[model samples]
Target: MEISDLERIARDIRRRDIQAVYEAGAGHVGGEMSVIDLLAALYFHVLRIWPDQPKHPDRDRFVLSKGHTACALYVVLAERGFIPEDEISTFLQPYSRLNGHPNCNKVPGVETNTGPLGHGLPVAVGMAKAAKLSSANYHTYVITGDGEMQEGSNWEAIMAAAQFKLDNLTLIIDHNRFQQGASLSETNDVAPFRPKLEAFGWEVTEINGNAMAEIVPALEHRGGRPHCIVAHTNKGHGISFMQDRVDWHHKVPSKEQYELALAELSEAL
Candidate 1:
């Protein structure tokens, strides 16, 4: 897909994200909106995968570490034909497979179930190592919330990845600077991510996480060791009222708020 097409798809994804959250009455709206562009670039242009063959062994792996934003992933997966787009309406409903977080067993495109803050990186590291050990030609990518990096497990995986020199692994940190209840500074600042990853023997790239151009290149870059992309992003990226606001982290927008947000996103298309 062309960059222009990806940009339009991202806007559509943002619109879907808002609608899904509004209808479900719950979701990680802020983070979901913040990461849709990155998701679009991956699903549409970067990752090598077939929606019809979700289990293809050679397909690249992607684990959304900040899986509370599963709503956004669902929208992207739906748009990319992994699942029916209409199924999105059932999100968060009782007994619905589209729960608040993704479930790989039930969701077509999800590589693994993820919700716990620090789980995805270790799993992705293992996946990368497995590919290296087995000589499988596949890449492993994981995206984690910046706040979640405070978990010690990620650093352990970091060490193991660097030691193993898993060049096929790509870790993208959605550095939106806000967590559930407050900004990272108010909670625990994990800034200066690039230096830390580089010090751990990984090549690092920092980019405007919301820009389609920046996102695609950052995700596609490869090196001789594990790679990390520090994606600086706003909390609620597409909406005028929500950007950088901590309150939108998990709070449902009011009807008026939703209308305004939808308009702001749709206008971009």
Candidate 2:
């Protein structure tokens, strides 16, 4: 797909995300909005996988570390045919497999269940290393929130990934600078991640995480060290008023706010 189409798809995903949140009465909307472009660019363009063959042995892997934004991942997966697009409406509903966090057993495209913030990278590392052990050539990708970097488990996995020379692994951090209750500065700021990651022996690429042109190249980079993309993005990227606001972390919008958000995202399409 063209970059222009990816941008349009990201906007559509945002529309779907807003509607799902409004209907379900709750979600991590702020983080979902920030990461939709990265998700769209991955499922639509970068990742080498077939929707019909969800468990294909040789296919690339993606673990959404920040699984609270599963709504956005669901929208992108639906758009890419991993699931029915209409199924997105069932988000957060009782008996729906589409919950706040993704489930690998129930969701076709999800590689693992992740919500605790630090688990996805370790799972992705195992996947990448397994490919090596089997002499299979496939990449492994994982996306984590910047705040989640405070977890010691992630650092442990980072050290292991570097020690094993798993260049096929790519770690994309959604550096939106806001977490659940407050700004990263107020909570725990792990900013200037590029140097920190590089010091740990990974090649770092920084980009405007919301920009399609910069995203593809960063994901496609083939370096000898385990890779990291410090994606600088806004909290609620596409919607005007919600951008960078910490209060939108899990806050539901008013009916008026929802309509305005819909209108704003619709214009992007």
lDDT of 2 by residue, 1-269 (tens): 89999899899889999999999999999999999999999998999999999999888999999999999999988989999999999999999999999999999999999999899999999999998899998999999998898888999999999999999999999999999888888887778898888888999999999999999989989989999999999999989999999999999999999999999998877
Q: Pick the candidate with the highest lDDT.
A: 2
What is the overall TM-score of model 1 with all chains considered together?
A: 0.98
Q: Mind giving the per-residue lDDT tens digits that candidate 1 earns over 138-217?
A: 99999999999999999999999999999999999999999988888888776889888888999999999999888988
Q: Return the TM-score for candidate 2, rounded to 2 decimals.
A: 0.98
Segments of candidate 1 deviating more than 4 angstroms: none
Q: What is the C-alpha lDDT of each candidate?
A: 0.92, 0.93
lDDT of 1 at 148: 96
Q: For model 2, what is the error of residue 209's alpha carbon versus the real structure, in angstroms, after optimal superposition?
A: 0.3
